[model samples]
Target: MLALRDSTQYAHMTPAHPCDSDDPERRFRPLSPVETCVDTCGLARDSAPYFSQHNKRYGVLTMANGKQATARRLKMADRAQQLQDLHFPGMPEILLWHRNRHDGFITIPRTLPIVMQAVDAQSKGQPAGHTLFCLWARSPDHPVLSIENPSTFAAEAGFIGERAVDTWRRRMKKLRELHCIETKPGASGEFHYVLLHNPNAVMEWMHSVGLVRAELYSRFIERLADVGAFGEIEAVRQLWAQQQAAEAASAAAQTAATVPAAEADATAQANAAPEASAKVQIALPELGANL
Candidate 1:
């Protein structure tokens, strides 16, 4: 058997397997569990190609349709047609939200449900999740949105009773406190304009603040990874680390610059003191001789 090192350069090759070595003693060595998964447990037959010797080193497997490699690039109309055929044949294409024609849809993270649960856990008995969703729905594909009518928003968020608007406002405040949104006072009220934050980033911040439960966080991470979006959080963390390192380096440089100047000033003061002392001694001797 041939071995492929666990590297992106050889990622197209069959999952790393134990290679036949010339050393007889090591020939029977078993493959580690991680390396043996493809051979022993196996991937979905439709999704993974069969390993063969002819193309073992050179061939690349085409991922399944709707997999990460092709899903995003697959035309929206094609995807909708595929879904329609599979689930509801003869469905009118005109009714579908085809990308070429639709205009009023909002993009959202796949992990939003998990985020909603996290928010609800932090602010119990409040429709904070509903309010957050409502805000997203109202947004015009932008992070910032203006709520011109609190009463209408309250109704949309399912807040009822005479104080529905008041309840909605409370949830809105909770969302701001959780760092999911930012608000500023405007003509509408205290939270007339709202700025929505990335749900994944907000979840990360909540996790740091001890607001996210470990189990929920695990699920959230898994969902993000599934959607190939976990990198966004990691990228943010890396950027923050880079900023901190830059700040530390800048501070060190300033301290280094200041120390040299401070030492020079001290040396000048010390040298002047000796000269002043010598001059005083000379004056005293002159005065004595004159006397």
Candidate 2:
């Protein structure tokens, strides 16, 4: 027997529950009522067994279908109720922001802090880390962002003074030089369109170029393993190798195709030479007889 207050609050369904009914209105009809009690109630239906109002509370006395999924849902419902109980009076049920709700968020790599450290270690004076963070904040959960206004971005990146924009540009250049980002010329400037690279790949590149310190690289690897992202570096490398192989195969095929055409042309030209000589001999008179 299940105690259900609201259909939306539980997901246990008896084996004979008409959950898959073609008639949407008749969905979730209880199988066989042992005792009919009631007042018709209006409630949002989800995945609950059909129930009736009993003493102003909705209740259903039925056996669950005994599915593992159903059990899991029951446990989840309990956990959700527990969390809801923690909500205090006068406070909204949801205080934290989530991606599911709306915009005003950016998703970045979990290993971003290590990547930033690696970037800063490359140049002591420049604050490329801050610039990178600013770029990420401005992005819409994508790798691309436009930096149209230099002064505005400079301020956002914590740069100040008369040369603040210049300072910001230098850090941008540094990021590009390290392969953390790629940029293109636009109406704004050289870095008007910036395409951020995966920081994990950038870290791997830095390690290859000796830009990342050994200790930091070790930590980065460990953190990646912890977060199940360690394979991304090797995955990127393998993808690059596959691309190179494909390009080489395409170029070789093109060369082979051109060589066959050239050979066929040469054969045709050779065969045509003898026929032309024979025609010339047939057209001319014998030299001695003509004299």
Candidate 3:
């Protein structure tokens, strides 16, 4: 049972005794729930009964029908009462809501949708995006829907049809031209788009194209990092550390070069002061003698 109240006062209100669905209509805002998986997954949801080897936080749950399922968040207060009560015995607030996974193929990455629907989450090889994307890829039976195949990517991602694929592919070409992505030749004469790895560069590019906001861009990058995307995050951090070290070394060298010049200038000033004083004394005595 879910309930709703004023957003400001929602925290103070006591939980109603299992009220009917009192949640109101959603505000006029588009929704995104999925996230790009990280290398490490946190504790599993209270509702889920199983766990995945890779995603230690939660295993893909087995439903009544024995179909392995993943978690999807509800737009409304799926578990508001639990959080509001402050007495609910369960996992942390982050894993409060235990809802069904959204069923569909997604073209966009996780952290955007927060919803995924699939039979098996682990198949083919893992990639940097959603650990779920591993399951979302083209299976033999589901071959028609994979992103690698264009048509599937279009449909699942909200594109129209085969025609949409050509348009999107063309758009990808334009994006490639802009250097947002790189298109490399793959087997079977197909082209694969390698996403740019730099989060700052990606954010700037997305903003320039009106695709993301500061908040969403940050969230997107965070989720991408979670799922081991952009290669290894540790590796990226290492590179950043190395760059900082190089810059520090350069600054130190520059300071060292200036120190010698500064010392020489000081020494020259001290020597010149005695010579000037002696000349002034000698000139004054000669003028006195002549007078």
Query: Which candidate should be chosen as best, given lDDT against the real structure?
Result: 1
Q: What is the TM-score of each candidate against the true structure?
A: 0.59, 0.53, 0.30
Higher lDDT: candidate 1 or 2?
Answer: 1
Q: After superposition, how far is residue 97 of candidate 1 from its true place, in Å?
A: 4.1
- Candidate 2 residue 32 C-alpha distance from true site, Å: 68
Deviating ranges (above 4 Å) for candidate 2: 1-103, 243-291
Superior candidate under lDDT, 2 versus 3? 2
Estimate, for each residue in 1-291, the C-alpha lDDT of model 3 and write its tens digit: 111223434322222111111233212112221222232343221111111222232211112211211222331254666566675666575664433444444344443232221101111131122322332343233312223565655455345754866644554454344333454555412334344323334433443465554445444434444443423333554576799999999999999999999999999999999999999999999999999
Off by over 4 Å in 3: 1-201, 204-215, 222-228, 232-234, 286-291
Error of 1 at 270 (Å): 18
Clashing pairs in 2: none
Clashes of 3: 18
lDDT of 3: 0.40
Candidate 1 lDDT, 1-291, residue by residue in tens: 122333345433333322333342332333231122354435322112222321253332222222662465466547866887999997786876665688778878778889999999988867498789889988998999998999999999998899999989899989999999999999999998899999998998897678988668756754564565655776666777899999999999999999999999999999999999999999998999999
Query: In model 3, which range of ten residues has the least summed lDDT?
Result: 115-124
- Model 1 RMSD in Å is 9.9
Error in Å for residue 28 of model 1: 22
